[model samples]
Target: MRISRLYTLLLPAIVACGGEGDSTSTTTSDQTLDVDSIAAAVADQNLPSDSLNEYLRENPFDVDALIERADRFIRSKNIPYAEADVKAALELDSLNPRVLLYWGDVNFYKNQTRQSRDAWMKCIEVDPNNVDCRLKLAELYSIVQNYRESLRLVNKVLEIDPSEPVAYFIKGNNIRDLKGDTAQAVRYVQQAIELDPEYWAALDYAAVMLANMHDPTAEVYYKRMLEIDPNHQPTYYKMGMFYLDQEMWNESIAAFTKATQLRPSDAESFYNLGYINLELGVNDVAIDYFNKSIQARQVNHRAYYGRGFVYERMGDLIRARSDYQQALAYNPQHEPSRIALQRLAEKMAQ
Candidate 1:
C-alpha cells in the first residue's frame, strides 16, 4: 500500500531528529538530540562564515573543522557543499560516527534513501547507542513499507529513552499503518505530545487523527499548533481539510486562503479553495479560484473539471465542453469530467 502524503511528510522530521554526536562528550547518546533544536543552539555558537573560511584555510585537514563547516552548509540548505565536507571528513576518519551521521543527513536531503540508510546504519554499528540513527532507520523502513522492522527499531528507541517524543510519534504512525488501529495510535501520539508539548510534528499528527475521529478537540490541537508556529503552511492546509470534512465551508475557505497566502505557489491550496467556493454555489468565485489553481499548476485536471462545472452552470456550453475535454486529456479516468462531457453531448443533441 502506498503511504499517505501526510505520513510521508513526517519522514523528514523523523530522520532530522538525530544530530551528529559531539566527540568531546563522554556519552554518545547526547549526539542523538533533536536536530532542529540542536541546530538552533549551534547557530548561536557557530563561527561566522568568514571566520570559518579563514580557519579552514589555516587548518585544511582538520576533521572537526570540516564537519563544523559542513554543518553550517547543511543549516543553509546547501547540500552539495555539506556533502563535500562530509566526504572530506570521512576520508580523514572512515569510522567517525559524527561524519557518518552527517553523511546520512546529506544523502537523505538529496533523496538518496539507500545511501542515507547505509550511512546511518554504519553510524549505529560504530556506536550502537545512537538513538538518532536508530530512529532515522526506523523512519526509512516505514517509508519502504517494512512496518515490522520499523516497529522493532522504534521499540528499541523507546527502550533506550522512554521519554523520547519522536519515538512515541513513530510508534503511533506504525501502529496506525500496520493495524489500522487509529484509537491506539491517537493514544501513543498523545503521549508524545504530553512528553513534549512543543513538538509540532506530534501536535499536527494528533490533530489529524483527532479530526479523523470526529473529535472537536482536533480544532484545539490545531489552534495550539498555530500558536506555536503560525507560518507552518502544512498546518493550515490540514486545518482546511479538517473543516472541509466537517462541512464548514466558510472555515475551510478561510483556512485554505491562509494556506495559499503562506505558500503562493501551492496549487493544491488554491484547488481546495476553488472546490469550497464551487460547493457554496458561488460559480464566478469558484471559476476565478480555479483559474488561479491552474496558473499555479497548469496540468491540474481537477482545476479544469472545476472550471468546466462553473462554465456549464453559467450556460456557456462551448467553454464547458472544452474544459471537460481538457480535464479528460489530463486524466482520462476522471469520472466527473467524463460524466460532464457525456451530459453536455446529450444536451447538445436536444
Candidate 2:
C-alpha cells in the first residue's frame, strides 16, 4: 500500500539483441561503427545514408547486414524500418533465433504485445536456453498483470543462472504486487543489490520497500542511490513521500521542491508540494502549487481538491466551491470533492 502517487520504474527486459550471449555477435561489421553514434549522425544528415544504401544494394541478400541495420533502427525508435529489416531477414532465414528476437523487439515497440509474445516464444522454441526471450515474455506477462506467469518465467531464468540480479528484481516486484509481501519482496531486491551493488533498479526498489516498512534507514539507501545517479528525479520524489509519511514537513518540502525543479512538468510532484504546504498551514503557497499542478496536467483532480482546501481555509467559499466542482468534473468518483461540495452547500443553506 504505497501512499505515493508516484509510479515505480520497472527496468525493461533485456531484448535478445542486447542480451548476454546474443547470437548477433557473429554478425558484426569490420568497420566497428557505434550504432547510436551512426544513428545520431544520420539524424543530423552529417552521415551519408548512401554508404548503408550502397552496402545493401551490393549485398541484397545479406541477412546479417539487414539484422544489424534493424538493431540500429530499433535503438533509434524507427520501428517501421526495424520491422522492414527484420521481416527481410526472416524471409532469408525464418528459423534464425537472432532475427526472431529482433522481430519480437520491433512488434513490442509497435504495441502488438501478442505478436511480440509469439515471436519471443518462437525464439525460445528455436533455442530452449534463450534466457533473454524468456525474460521478455515474463515482462509482457507482468504488464498484463499475469504475475503468476511472470514469476514462473523469472524462476526458470533463476534456475538457469541463480546469480541473475535482474531476475531477482523482477521476482521481487511480482511478489510485492501479487502477494502484498513487502518484507519478502525487500529480501529479494536486497539480494539483487548484494549481487551487484551498482544495480540502480535494485537500489530504487530497495528504497521503496524500506520506505513502505517505515524503516528510517531507507534514507541511507536513497542517499546511496543519489550518490550513484544524481539525475534520478524519482528518488527525490519518493524521498519526499517517505518524509511526508513520517510528518517531517520541512524535509518533505525540500525533497519535493528538488523533484519539481528537476522535472518541472511533473504534476504529481506539484500536487504533493501543495498537499504538504496545506499540511503546514501555508494556505497561499499551497494554492499556488496546486495551480501549478493543474497547469502541468489539467486532469489532476487531486490538484483541484487541494486548491479547494486552501481556498476553504482562507474563507474564500466561492472559489472553494468552484474548485470542488472542477475536481468532481475531472473525477466523478472523487468522494472527497463530493463531500466537500456537500458540506459547502449545507453551509450556504445555513
Clashing pairs for predicted structure model 1, backbone only: none
Candidate 2 lDDT over 124-219, as tens digits, reads: 899987777777777777767789998999999899989877778889989988999989988899998888888887898799879989999788
In the range 144-183, model 1's lDDT, one tens digit per residue, is: 6688888999899899989887788888989999999999
TM-score for each of the candidates: 0.72, 0.72
For each candidate in the order shown, give its overall lDDT on alpha carbons.
Answer: 0.80, 0.78
Candidate 2 residue runs with Cα over 4 Å from true position: 1-62, 145-148, 197-201, 294-301, 311-350
Model 1 regions more than 4 Å off: 1-47, 52-65, 83-96, 106-119, 264-266, 314-319, 348-350
In terms of lDDT, the poorest run of 10 residues in model 1 is: 1-10
Q: Give the Å shift of residue 154 in candidate 1.
A: 2.3
